[model samples]
Target: MDTAAYALLVFGALAGGFVSGLAGFGTALMALGIWLYVLPPSLAVPLVLICSVVAQTATLPSMWRSFDFTLIWPFIVGGLAGVPVGTLLIAHADPQIFKLGVGLFLLVFPTVLFFNRTPMAFRFGGKVADAGVGFAGGVLGSLAGLSGPLPILWASLRGWGKDERRGIFQIFNWTVLLAALCYQAATGLIELKVIWLALIAFPGTIIGASLGTRLYHALSDRNFGDVVLGLLFLSGVGLVWSTLGLR
Candidate 1:
């Protein structure tokens, strides 16, 4: 085994897992810096997927049976389709542009949400909106490890029910992560080493997500939303720092 690689993988798993719990996402954005230090970016992608799958799967139970399927299915269908396109886009995009785009979104999205008394709320115009989110997710997922965040951000800003958000995010993320993992694996980006690293993260992700589920119990709807959104902002800042070679 690669001792140094293994060590970083373990630590990354722990940090990534906790963040995933406290927030609904950020597992990849938080862990990627550390993972890339030991492994290639291509390999990092699948490892992220595996760890995310573990995290989201564990959290799905609390979210299950609480979703608006009319809403869930269409949006998820979009996300499922969106992720692979995003994955493919990632391979071809210019690094500088990619960095700038993610940076802008990270900096702007949360600020807008924080300042606004009310965001756009919901823009679903029947099934079309669902397809649009999926397509957006697929496109973004193809390019960046983040696909579900935009749709999720809308959900967060609108202050949807915790169970609905969790359930919706679980399906959206799971689909994106799984699809991205497949693309990486088929392209030979994933190796046994990565799988081992993902395995190491499994326990941590599960534990953290479980804690979040429990924490959800005591929070008022507004507090829970604030907590998750706050965590996402911090995570975004961390990513920006890392991208700038500061983290």
Candidate 2:
């Protein structure tokens, strides 16, 4: 790669790492959008997965004390099942259409949350419901490298505290992205170029994640939720733009 491409890759990694560190998700949403400017989807997606896992793992030690297996296990099981299905669809499905649909949902869902201030008061079913959301997350993870939005939105609706939400986001993202990375490696979707880019990007990931985790610790639960919602909205806009060939 040229210096310009390398620079862009590093910058994208830093930005995406910071976002993931703060919000406990959104590494792909932030990095893939920027990386796609310099690399194709085939290359960019795997790089995003590598950086995401790195960022999430970096923050895990801080969140381990608050981890809730009961809430996260069902989602993991459901998401694991959905990933292969999504991977299969990638070869057969029109990705632009899928992106458009998901973008619309992301846009509308946040608006609903913004208007409905008492979102948590409305119970959104039980563990079965959580698993269903996780399945959707897995499908999106495999299809778009964007599995966090659905679960992030669900955590908001369920009225989890910042730590609780972070626990879910950190563990869930790590699990799904790690699995996706392994799948990509096994299928030979991950190339040597992607590995080189990951190496170039690692330092930025560490720096940004360190800064972002500090910021995350400082924010109130309400403020953190608002920030997450805002990022989701922006990610939706990015998806819509890409699907329309505007980016």
* Collision count for each candidate, in order: 12, 0
* Lowest-sum lDDT 10-residue window in model 2: 116-125
Query: How big is the positional error of residue 34 in model 1, measured in Å on the Cα after superposition?
Result: 3.5
The most accurate candidate by lDDT is 2
Superposition error at 202 for model 2 (Å) = 1.2
Candidates in order, TM-scores: namely 0.86, 0.95
Local error of candidate 1 at 129, Å? 2.5
Model 1 regions lying over 4 Å from their true place:
1-7, 157-159
- lDDT score, residue 51, model 1? 84
* Candidate 2: tens digits of C-alpha lDDT, residues 1-247: 7899889999999999999889899888888888888898778878888999999999888778878888888788878878887777767878679778888888889878877777483366688888898888988887768889998899888888888888888888889888887886888778998888899999999788888898999999889988988998888898899889984
